[model samples]
Target: METAELEPQVLANRLGVEFYLVRQNNTIGCVITIAALEAHFWLESRASDARILKTFRNGYGRICAIAERKWLARPAATRLELTPADFARR
Candidate 1:
C-alpha cells in the first residue's frame, strides 16, 4: 500500500471517505473528509500509507475526538457523527 503511488480516489474509497491531496511548496499531504452519524470532518496526514494506517489503527480515538469537535462547531443536519467505536466495527 504505497499511498504515493495510489490515486487519491482509490485511497478515499478504501477508507470510505473523500480525500484531497494538498501540495504546498515542496510538501505533499492528504486531507481525508469523513461523514459520520450527522456530521463531517477531516483528518490530515503527511506520513506514508503504512504510517497513516498505523495511526488509524492506534490513534483513532484522537481522530474521532477531532472529528467530534469539528462536528460540534459546525453541526449539520445531513451528516452523521462517528466515533472511534464506529470505525472499530468497520
Candidate 2:
C-alpha cells in the first residue's frame, strides 16, 4: 500500500488494535498498537534500517520474534496512545 494512501484506522481494525494518530511536522507517522506482546510490523519500511535488514536475513525467526516476543506488527497501538486523556477520564 502507498504511504500516502495509508488507511491507518482500517489497518487498526484489521489488526484488532486501537488506532491513534501521531503527527510530526504536520504529517502523520503511524497507527501503532500498545500491545504488551507481539510486534507491530509493517509490510514495507519507508526508511530501511540495518537492524531490520539483518532481522529479515534471519528468516522465519523475524516473524516469530515479532509475533511472539514483542508487539512489532503493524496493527499494534502505542502504549501512550490510549492514555486517560485520550478518552473519558471516568
Alpha carbon lDDT of each predicted model: 0.40, 0.31
TM-scores for every predicted model: 0.33, 0.20
* Candidate 1 Cα misplacement greater than 4 A, ranges: 1-47, 77-90
Q: Which lDDT tens digits does candidate 2 get at residues 12-87?
A: 2333222223334232233222221123333233323343333333433433333332333334534323221222
Inter-residue clash pairs, candidate 1: 36-80, 36-81, 37-80, 37-81, 38-79, 38-80, 38-81, 39-79, 39-80
Q: Rate residue 36 of model 1 by lDDT.
A: 34
User: Considering summed lDDT, which 10 consecutive residues are worst modelled in model 2?
Assistant: 80-89
26: Cα error in model 1, Å: 38
Model 1, position 48, has a per-residue lDDT of 48
